[model samples]
Target chain A: MSNKVIEISNLGKQYRLGQVGTTTLSDDFKRWWYAFRGKEDPFLIIGDTNDRTKKGSSDYVWALKDINFSVNKGEVIGIIGKNGAGKSTLLKILSRTTAPTMGEYKIKGRIASLLEVGTGFHPDLTGRENVFLNGAILGMTKAEIRNKFDEIVDFSGVERYIDTPVKRYSSGMYVRLAFAVAAHLEPEILIVDEVLAVGDAEFQKKCLGKMKDVSGNGRTVLFVSHNMSAVNSLCTRCVYLKNGTVYSIGDTAKIVETYLSNESNAESCKVWDPSVAPGDSVARIISARVTDDKGLTIDHMLRDQKVGIEFEYEVLQEGHWPIPNLHVFNGSEEYAFVSVENELEYLSKKGKYRSVVWIPADLLNDGRYVFGLALTTMKPNVNVHFYAENVLQVEVIEDISKRNTSYNQRLPGVVRPQLNWETTLLSD
Target chain B: MADMKTEPDEEHWDLVVKPKSSLFTLNLAEVWAYKDLIMLMVKRDFTAIYKQTVLGPLWMFVQPLFTTAIYTFTFSTSAKLSTDGIPPILFYIMGQTFWNYFADCLNKTSGTFISNSAVFGKVYFPRLVMPFSVVISSLIKLGLQILLLMAFYLYYYFTTDQLHPQWTLALLPAYLLILGVFSLSLGILFSSFTTKYRDFTFLLTFAVQLLMFASCVVFPVSMYSEKVQNILMYNPVVSCMEAIKYSLTGHGLFSWYYLSFVLLVTFIFLIISVVIFNRTEKSFMDSV
Candidate 1:
């Protein structure tokens, strides 16, 4: 027998993007006419692959276009994408929750998907009843469910409330029971969405471990998640998606790195002007740019390198104002450091003023970071100025050549604390 | 952990991406494979309906019983309508019990798309199983009401010197088969329509009630003129209900031609229902 468990070719999904009503009827008639004449669909020609992001002249958009790939047995793949990138649509099509608008695929084994937690659960039903209901929905036979019932209950940790209605249980308890049922379903292929985001850290770890065990048991798994760390740790390979199309499909680390780099470049260096800013204030942040001391724009920088943020603004009226301040933030959107030059107060004696905020070397740790800058007037009120949020990127790299320090040192929050620690034992 | 030092084969386990299937079959055969799920859904519907109620399954009998009482008072007493000499209670109960089954099936199945849209939206299953299970569960209610009819029949039979109905009673199963097919067809047809034009939901209850009156549930169709009788017999349910009473009590009307007509109509309805249901299943998720 061939090792391939699933094979797909030239798969595409076309979706109509307007109110689905009379338009559907007319479109159906047009599709029928084309089919009757043995011609390709007229509406399909309106969408071009190169400009997939652009809205088509017709209401139809190909959510997935020419998606071709094959899956051997026992492979775990991660689908990584930004929002609205057709990731969920692809999973939905594979799980048979929906069908593709075009193309065909053949599966050699049964597939079970956990697209959403508590999907098949009825809130009014008890957990024990929902177990069977959801299991049955997942295509498990009664004997299979009976064999795995105890393991499912034990894994969920809701033994005490197994017979209680799910509506009465906490959401965490509900998700646990739902996941347990799905995890133990034993389908040949398993598909999971990013529903683990709702669970706590410990539960997420448990779920990820269960997923690893599942894939290890020679079953295929397709996982969709925005958590790059989890994707990198769990998946053997990943498909990166951008704007409803496949950007790249390859090594998990490389794809994730590409995705991160693209995101950093897109949002990091933005040319701002008075018209583009949101707020109507005394001062407006006209432009903000992150660069090295040599004035070259950079998204990745060394941990100990000096990073500079250039800010340009045009003052509406000439007056004394507080000096510009810059704040650095990490991926979690938490502010890491705020540098303010309050003592060096200056007035906009001219039409426009330019300033640059600098961070000295060795002040940050290794990770991706964002920068925010504000130009506030200090005289009238603290907030009388322009403030930009999360608009710059700075990445810190650690030198792997160094061997004196442990590589597993803890990195917490947006900033790494550079505090020194010393230990001594006291004797009686 | 058992083989912690073993070098896992990383090259062979790489992710394989593929295009998704364009065509999907609902596989009613698979639904047959999961027959236990059908039974469980039926049981859940059966138990949950009356679980917390004080009267429990007693509510099943109460509906037909009260409707029978009202029919007996309004048509038998107030209007003094002829029942073709069969007892008023037997006639009314027979009509109410049989017609209620069909109505229940129609109403429940018609609401299947709207009532369970939330559950159906999140999960993938043979959507047909839902309405099929509803029809089966309503049959249980029909079975209970039939028992109540039998009780009244026994009381009237043993009390009076009237002879029990002849071997034609064997045809009762035939009548029930016709009713089942007719109701299933109408129910599925209405369900397919209600998935889109939800205004049908508001009109459904009133339509069922008006249909009950027109189907001769309150009185015998024999009481009407020949012109009206022909018009009423055009409704397949009227023929099924009249056939049921005729088989049980040896009273009102029985015509092989009418039964054949009803069978033909029922077959057409069922074929149409299946066609519409098949078409609706493909894209109802989008519309619903």
Candidate 2:
């Protein structure tokens, strides 16, 4: 049987950005008046296509525009994009949670969307009741949930709390129960958002295993997540979105490489103007930059080259001995290391101060990594004044041309330790 | 989830989503497929109301019983409202029981978009199921409350020579169906409207109270002036509530002509509300 599940074409969703708390009654009147004329909506003409970098000219913006892709049955497709790149919007449209503003998509077979772990879980309900309730919400029949009832409870490992209300369960237990019910869903087409990075690490492994079991059954899956490593392992294909449009779509590895390299290339250096300095009056991050030893702004550096992160901040208060810190997370969003300067000598005064931290050569793995900075007063009162997450990103790619060994592949880990190896022949 | 068993036509697409969706696409199959979910929602709404309460489901019976006493005191005693030879307690309990069913459906379904926005945004189900569940659960409550009305009914039937039931009681099933659908239609219409503008929520509570008076729930339609009766006749709910009274007591016109007119109006109202609801379901998450 030739198996194909989904075919989407020219899909788009436009949103009107404003103070949505209360729209004037006149706007409703205008919309009705224009809708009656059989003309294109009067507001649609004023919509600027969604490009977050550019200052939009109108209140209307397309959350997803002209998105086109097709999935053969059993293909696990990963969708990766930046915060505003419309990944969620595309998933919403495909899952039928929300409709596209334009164009169409043809879908075969039943589709169930696990957009979040517990989309419809009622906290007051018992865990067992929530299992049935959530399963039914995800398009499962009562018999299906009943048959999988024990398996779901066993998978969640919350048997003791089965009869207790979900609200009484800890947050981790709540996620496990919610995810257990979600895992029992066996729809032909499954659409999942970034709900996998929850619970303990072991449950996440079980979830990934369950997803693998799903696609192994020749079921099509659409997964959206910012976790690149998870996508790299689970997806055969990938769709990269940029500003509400498809930037690229193809092999998972190639598309991921393209998304990471292109994304970091544009964000190697970040500057916060005085108007938009993202901090309270206590302190403000002026600039954060990733550079090489030669002081050149670099998106790509040799695996052995020293990487430098320089963060300049303007402190506007005294008695605040601020500790500037950096947290490095690898491409998979795992925290590689955190380096905070806690030297007791420097009492931070009201002035522009810059802190530069350098990483030794060959210390980090040959992969993409991002920087997060925080300014906190950790003395009498440990209060975090400001923290800038993902201030800069860099890629430490292996130089293939300079390889000597037969195997010239990058190793996988948070860091690559280059320790001296002593190999003396024992019985020469 | 049920399997889609048709042969895979690689060239043929199953659904085409366009900017202008077909307005009348009810997709009853999709709704039916989610029937289990509808039942759970109804169960949840029914039980969730009485959870941790002292009286539990007894509150359902007690509410209408107490309201009957209050209404008899206010409308029958002070205002001297006539009950057409039926005793005041039995009359008011009957009116309140039936009107509560309609009012509950309208109140709950009207807030469907706002209240369920959290679940609705994260997942996709036939949005009609929410209001449909409201109607079903309200029917369940109505069934429970009807027992209290029945007690009064049986008391009045044996003791009082005034009670006279008509053969139109056979039409009670059809009347309830009309009443349920009419409430669903209006509730869904208001639900769709409240998604964008919240002004209707406040208006709805007041409007339902006004609707009860307009339907002649507390007073006989014949007691009104001719011009007022003409206006009340145009309200489909008047036909619905009056038909119920006529069925039980056989005191007024049990006219099939008026009942059919009410059904037609309800059918039209249902279609219009469904259109508005379908459109809102697609993009209400954006504005809601």
Candidate 3:
């Protein structure tokens, strides 16, 4: 039998741009008139591609247009996109919370979508009651919920408070109970959208583990989330959406790399006008740049080249002795390292100050890196003057010539530094 | 084309989502498959409303009892409305019991899309399950009110020779069945429109109040002229309510033609409402 459980083709959804009012009736009339005369919908041809940043002349926009992909049984597919790229819209259509305006899709077996957890949970209801209520809302039968009632309670770890109204439970406890019900849903095709954004770190880990277990049982899963690391670890394949259209669909690593690299535009130098620069009364970041040792501002460099992050800031108020810090993050948003300069010999008059930190050659992995700049004071209390999260982004490319090994492939670890080694051959 | 060879039977696919969904798609089987959900929703609606209350479920009896008392006080002596020789308290309670159920069902089910939009937006089930559960939950409330009515009913039957419950009392379930069908269908239809437009909500609240006066809730149909009676019987709720009153007190109008007319209208409205409701559920998320 064919393993492809879901087949979507040429799917699209068109939405009106503004508030529904007088224009809706006219549009409806126009649509009716066209249909009556055996013509096409007049507005269908006039929609702009959905790009929330830009204002378009047309009153209609295609939130998703011409989307086509198929998922085989047991394959975990991650849908990643920038906000308003139709990620949620696609999931809504796939889960049938909404219908597409164009094309069709066929699916085999049951599909359960958890676009949100605890959708129908009543605050006055006890956690035990909410488990059954939420499970039913997610399409579990009473028998199934009954069968897994104990297990769900055990998984949520709120058994002591099961009979207590969820209103009294902490938000963490509530989400745990809700996700517990969702995690126990054994559907053939599960479509999840960012339910892991809640809960503590440990709970999130448990949820991800449960999702992995779900997919391991020969079921198809569609996951849509902004957490790149979660998508990287959980999904085997990915579909990257840009401006409401499929940009690429392939192996998770390649698609995620394309998504992350394309997302930030990889700026090496960012300069701001002093008046509008990001800062408090203490200090303001004037400019930030990433450069190679040759002093050329660079957005990409070979792994063997030393990388320098330069920040220029003005201290508006002086006596506090401000410290400049650089926080480095890899492509998956995991912090590689944070470097803080705490040595300032004396507190002096306010003026422009520049700080630069050099990352050693071959010390970082060959992936996109983001630099965050912060000016802080450590006096009686620690206070951040300003922190620019994504001041500069640089891609470190692999240098094939530096390695003599037969394997010319990417190595594991956040930093792939070349360390001095002594190999004493023991009678091999 | 390749699918035709690889999967010869398209029926092998469990679901086929299409742009042009058919209008008459009422998946009774799908609704049946979600029976547990429907029952759970019913329980949620039933139990959740009474939570954190002093009276709890006892409040169910309070509303109808007070309404019956108010109706008897206002319309019994002051308005001197005819009840066809049945005592005013029993008459008012009988009508109030059935009317409250019908109105409660309509009122709750009619707000299914609006009231449950938070839950509806995030999950996918047969949207019909919402209104179906509303009807069932209101039936449970009605069940409680019926017991209250029976208390007054038995007292009147014992004391007054005028009280005579006909053998048609056996058809009480049938009357309630018609009532459920009418309210469920009409409520579902109203809910479909209420999803997009706010006007229907105001109109429905106003219309339901007006509907009670039009139906034989507080007064009997016998008090009206032939023409007005003919017009009143056209309301499916009128026939169902009068049939219930007749089965209980044995004096209200119970015509076979009118009952069947109620059935027919209920049947037609059920089909249209389910179709419109199905279509509404598809894209209501956008407008809602």
Q: Give the C-alpha miss distance for residue B257 in model 3, angstroms.
A: 2.6
DockQ of every candidate:
0.24, 0.45, 0.64
Q: Please state the Cα-based DockQ of model 1 relative to the true two-chain complex.
A: 0.24
Which regions of candidate 1 deviate over 4 angstroms? A33-40, A47-55, A264-268, A280-283, A294-300, A312-360, A363-368, A373-387, A395-428, B1-26, B161-163, B199-206, B227-231, B264-268
Per-residue lDDT of candidate 1, residues A263-343 (tens digit): 653354777655777334456667777789899887788766788888787666666564688878765445688888644
- The sequence of per-residue lDDT tens digits that candidate 3 reaches over residues A1-428 is 67889988889999997797213877889899999999998888888998888988898889999998889999999999999999999999999988889988999998999999889889989998899888888888888999999999999999999999999999999999999999999999999999999999999999999999999999999999999989999999999999889999999999998888788743799998988888998789999899888888998998888989998988888678778889988988788899988668552458898888999987899888988899888777898899898769998898677686878787877777788889998997
**Clash pairs for candidate 3:** none
Instruction: Select the stronger candidate by lDDT from 2 and 3.
Output: 3
CA lDDT of A305 in candidate 1? 74
Chain B TM-score for the candidates in order: 0.87, 0.93, 0.95
- Which predicted model would earn the best TM-score? 3
What DockQ number belongs to candidate 2?
0.45
TM-score of chain A, every prediction, order shown:
0.81, 0.81, 0.90
Question: What number of backbone clashes does candidate 2 have, counting pairs of residues 3 or more apart or in separate chains?
Answer: 0
Q: What is the C-alpha lDDT of each candidate?
A: 0.76, 0.85, 0.88
> lDDT, candidate 2, residue A137?
88
Note the residue pairs that clash in candidate 2: none
